[model samples]
Target: MATIRERAGRWQAIIKRKGYPQQSKTFDIKKDAEKWARQEERAMDAGTWADQSAAMQTTLAEALVRYEKEVTSGKKGADTERVRITKWKRHKLAQKALGTLKASDFAGYRDARLKDGAAAATVRLELAIISNLFNVARKEWSFEGLANPIEAMRLPTSKNARNRLFLDGEEARLLQALAPAARGEDGRFGDGCANPLLRPLVQLALATAMRRGELLALRWENIRLADRVAHLTDTKNGHSRDVPLSSAAAEVLRALPRAIRGPVFPITPNAVKLGFVRAVERARKRYEAEGGKDERMLSDLHFHDLRHIAVTALAEKLPNIVELAAVSGHQDVRMLRRYYHPKAEDLARKLG
Candidate 1:
C-alpha cells in the first residue's frame, strides 16, 4: 500500500510493504508522486527494487579514494592516475552522492571543464577514470546497486593526434644547448653542464626511443652491454620487450656509472619534465643569441618527442610494421604509425 499526501505544498509518497523496507519520496506533482510510489512498490513485489541507500551514502570523492587504494594503486600508471583522481576530488562532481549522479551531471561537468579550457583529450581521460571507478565500485567493491551514470553520456571527440616531429638540425641544436648545463658548468657554460643525467638522458632517448617512464625505470640488471640488448621487464602494455641498443646507445650506457641496486637514470618524472623544460629554454635562448641558423629554437621540443624521432627512424629502416613493432615494443601497428612522422620531402623523392 502507498500513501500520497500534501506536505509543505509538495506531494509525498510513502510506500509500506511486507518483507521490504519502507520507501518514501517527494514530488512537486501528485501524479509523479503516485507514479513513483507505484513503481517502487511493484519493483519491491517483483524483487527488482534497488536500495537507494548505498548510492546516497557514497560520494564521488569517497568512491575515488576507495578506487585509488583498492584499484589504481596496483596499476603501472598509479602515479599519473592519482594525479587525475586528486584533481577530480576537488571537482564539484566529487561532492555529489553516487545515487544522485546522473548523465546530466556528467554532461554538465564535461561542458564546464571544456569551457574552463581543458582539452577534449584531457577531459576524456578524466571521464574514463570516473567510469572505471564506477565499474569497479559495482563489480568489485560491492556497490552493485550503484548505476554507472557516465555509461550513456556522450563523450567529447578525440583530439587530433600530435604530429610534432623534429626538423632536421633541430635535434643537434637542442642537444648542443643541453650539453653545457649537463656537463658541470656553474656559470654561463659553453660545455661544463651541471646535471650529469641530462645529456645522457636525451642521447639515450634518441637512441632507444624508450618512453620517459621506461627510461627512468631502466636498471643495470636489464642491460647486457656485450649483446647490445636491454630487457624491459614491464612495459606500458604489460609485455616485456628486448630493446636493441645502437653502438652509440651502448657506448652511452658504458659511459654511465652504474647504480648497484637503483635505476640507471635515477630521475623522477617531475625532475625529467622540469629539466627538459629548462634545457629547451636555455637552448633556444643561446642559439638565437649566437646568431644560429634557421632561427628556430627548440621551443616545442619535449622529452617524449625524442620517442617520436626514434620511431620515425626505426620505421624507415625496419622494412615492415612487424620489425618496427619489435624494436618499438608497440603492441599495435596503428599506434606505432602514429609516432612515425616521415618527412614529406623524402616521400616525394620516390615520385622522382
Candidate 2:
C-alpha cells in the first residue's frame, strides 16, 4: 500500500509492502508523488526494488571525504588527489545529493569548466575521481542502485601534448641560474639560486627522464653507481623498475655527498616548482642582459619537459623502442612515442 501527504509545501510519497522496509520520497507536486509511489510499489511487487535512501541522503562532498580517507590515501599520488578533492569540495555541485546527480549535470559542468579556461586534462582528471568514487560507493558503500553519472558522460578529448624543447645556450643559462649564489673576491654576490640541489636536480632530470615525483621521492640507498642503476620501488603506474643511469646521471650522484639512507634530493615538490619558476625567470633576465633578442628562447618551459627532453635524446642513442620504454618507465609504446620527438634532420640522418 502507498500513502501520499502534503508536508511543508511538498508532497511526500510513502510505500509499505510485505517483506520490505518502509520507503518514502518527497516531490514538488502531488502528481509526482503519486507517480513515484506507484512506480516503487510496482518495482517492489516485481522484486526489483533496492533501497536508495543512502544515495538520496549523502552529498558528493561527504562521499569525497570518505573516498579520500580510504581510497586516495593509499594511492602513490595521494598528494595530487588531495588537491583534486579540495577543488571538488569547493564547487557548488559537491553539495548535491549523490542520487540526484545525473549525466546532464556533469555534461554542463564539463562545458562550464572548458568555458572557464580549464584544460581538458584537468577536467578529465577531476571527472575521473568522481567516476571512481561512484564505482566505490556502488560496490562497497551500499549504493548499488546508483548509476555512475560520469560513465554516461563523453569525456573531453585531451590535445595538450607539449613538444617544447630546449634551445641552444638555454640549458647553459638555466644551469647558471640554478647555480649556487657565491660571494666574489670583490664582495659582490653573483646571480644564482640559494638552493644547491637545483642544478644537480635539473642535470639528473635531463639524464634520467624520471618524473618529478619519482625524482623528489628518490632515496640514497636506491642508487647503485657501480651498476648505474636506480631502483624505484614506487612509481606513478604502481610498478617498480630499475632505471638505468647514464654517465652524466652517475656523475651528478657522485658529485653530491651521499647520505646514509634518506631522500636523495631532500626537497619538496612545491619547493622544486617554485625554485624552477624563479630559476627560469632569472635565466630569461640573464639572456636579455647578454643582448639576446630571441623571445622564444627559454619561454614557456616546464619542469616536466625535462623528462620529454631526456627521452627524446635517449631515443637517438638507444634506437630500440623497447629499450627506451624500459629506461623511461613507459608501460605503453604509444605513450613513449609522445615523449620521443626527434628533429626531422636527425631522423633523415638516421635514414641515410
Candidate 3:
C-alpha cells in the first residue's frame, strides 16, 4: 500500500514496499499523486520497477565530466570533444539532473542556439555528445533507467557545404602575402612569409588533395620520392592510403628543409588556422591596393577550401570517377562529388 497526502497545498505520494527501496514523488494534483503511487507499486509487484536514483541524482555537468575522463579522453578527437564538453558545462541546462531532462528541453536548446546564430552542424554535434553520453551511461554506467532525451527530438540539419575556389590573381596574392622578406648580403629585406614552411604547405595542399591534418602529420620517413608516393599511417577514416605526389607536389617537398622533429610541417592546428587567417587578410588588402575590382577575391576563404580546390582541379586530369576516388582517398563516390565542383564553362569547352 502507498500513502497519499496533501502538504503545503500540494499532494505527495510516498510508497514504502518490502523487498525494495522506498520511492516518493510530489505532484500538483491529488489524482496525479495517487496515479503515480499505484503505477510504481504495481511495477514493484511485477518486478519491472527500475531505480532511477542515479540518474535523478547526477547532473549533466557531473555526467559530462565523467564521460570526458573515461570516454572522450580515449578518442582521436579528444581535445575537440573536451572543448565541446566544457561548453556544455557553461550552459544552464547542465544544472538539470539527467532523469529530469526531457525532449522539450533539448528542443528548446536547439531553437535557442539557432536563434543565437549557432550553426546547425555545431548544434547537431553538441546534441550528439549528450545523446552518446546517455547511451554510455545506460549501457556501461549501470543507469539502465535513464532515457536519451535527444533520441526523441529531431536534430538540426546542416546544408553548409562550402564550394570556395580561388579566384583569378587571388592565389598569387595569397602566396605573395605568405612569402617572407628576402635577406640580402647586407641583411636587407625583400616580399614573403617569415615562416619558410607556410608557402610550401599551401603549395603542397593545392598540388595534392591532402587535408590540413594529413599535411601537418606528414613525415619525411613516409615519403618515397623515387616512387612519388606519400604513405599515411593514420587518416580520418581510420584506413591508411598512399597519396601519389604530382611533379609540383614533389618539387615543393624537395625544396623544404627537412625538420629534425619528424613532422614535415611542425606547426600546430591553431598556428596554421591563425596564420592562414592573417595571410588571407593581407592578400585581400594587397589585391585592393593593386586595383583589383572584385570584392569577393580572396574574401571568406578558409584553409580547408584548399582541399576542395585541389579535388576539383584533379577531376580535370582524372576524369574517371574511380581513379579520382583513389587520389582523394574517398571511399564513397557520392562524397567525392561534394568536393569536385567543376566550372560549367570548362565543362562546355571540354564538350566542344
What TM-score against the true fold does each predicted structure earn? 0.82, 0.86, 0.82
lDDT of 1 by residue, 79-124 (tens): 7788889999998889988888999998999999899998798899
**TM-score for predicted model 1 compared with the true structure:** 0.82
* Top candidate, metric TM-score: 2
Report the C-alpha lDDT of model 2 over 45-68, residue by residue, as the tens digit: 788888888999999999999999
C-alpha lDDT of residue 174 in model 3? 90
| Candidate order, TM-score descending | 2, 3, 1
Q: What 10-residue stretch in candidate 1 is worst by lDDT? A: 180-189
lDDT of each: 0.82, 0.90, 0.88
Q: Candidate 3: where are CA atoms >4 Å away?
A: 5-12, 26-32, 45-47, 180-199, 285-293, 338-352
lDDT of 3 by residue, 1-352 (tens): 8999899999999988888888899999999999999888888888888888899999999999999999998886776688889999999999999999999999999999999998898899999999999999999999867889999999999976988998887888899889876887987654546567888899999999998878988999999888999998888888889999999999999898865448999886767877888889988888788788898998889998999999999998987778898888888899877656678997899999
The lDDT, on a scale of 0 to 1, for candidate 2 is: 0.90
Model 1 spans with C-alpha error above 4 angstroms: 4-12, 26-33, 176-195, 281-301, 334-352
Rank candidates by lDDT, best first: 2, 3, 1
lDDT of 1 at 219: 90
